[model samples]
Target: MKKETIKAGQITIDFLLEAADTNGAAAMFEFTVPAGAKTPLPHYHEHYDETIYGLSGVLTFTVDGKITDINPGETCFIPRGVVHGFDNLKQNDAKGLTIITPALLGPVFFREVADIVNQPGTPDLKKLGMVMAKHGLVPVVPKR
Candidate 1:
């Protein structure tokens, strides 16, 4: 399988291992979240669990209404169906490695997101939601 490096909006993801390379056991990737970058919205994955290990700097995560800071050597586990989002609130960039069990998500999802978000005009949130839904990621919609 080809290992791909993708720039998805404010983050860069380097795919290390994919489903085809691991017999569908897991998909692993390294990611860099630039300073001041935040996830567009909290989302939940219904088909897989994700574990993130911090490599450098600090990354702040909000999971199910709780906030946690992951520094170098620290880890965070987001279980399937749990709403979670992350951001780099520090002055420096944050690096992390993530593994998704069952290998349900891959580069394609990020690539699609990059395409939408990188467009010249404002991204269509509805279209973005559709892409996320296609990959089993359901973005949380804010209630009035």
Candidate 2:
């Protein structure tokens, strides 16, 4: 088991534990989003399920065209193939935890995002899309 604390985008991601290297089934993370931080574009994986538990503040999630605001102690689940995304909607930091099942790709994907966000210059969205696609993640275009 390995534990790591890293910053990704505007969030601090703490890899509370990982089962990818051994069990190949699950991974857990403690995530914190600074005020005003927005998550990545809405996307879905073909074979992984994700669950988020809100620890504090408000989490605004846009899932399958519906918007819901989850408060502290609330939890939301995104089944495989369902498009979902979230943002920290409070004036102060928002803290949460995420658990992913069938952990094959999700952990690697998060690590990549952290790497990209730390690189200088504006990120190339198209390239990022391609990277995401390669990992079975499909990015959805949000409604205008």
Top candidate on TM-score is 1
> lDDT by residue for model 2 over 1-144, one digit each (tens)?
337878777888888657745486887887888889857889898888888888888888888878988788998898999989888777988888888887756456667777777678877788778778877889997878
User: Which ranges of candidate 1 are over 4 A from the true structure?
Assistant: none
Each model's lDDT comes to 0.92, 0.80
Writing each residue's lDDT as its tens digit, candidate 1 over 18-136 gives 89898999999999999998567888999999999999999998989899999999999999999999989999999999999999899999999999998887888999999999999
How well does candidate 1 score on lDDT at residue 38? Answer: 50
Clashing residue pairs in candidate 2 are none
TM-score of each candidate structure, all chains considered together: 0.95, 0.88
TM-score of 2: 0.88
Error in Å for residue 46 of model 2: 1.0
* 35: Cα error in model 2, Å: 1.2
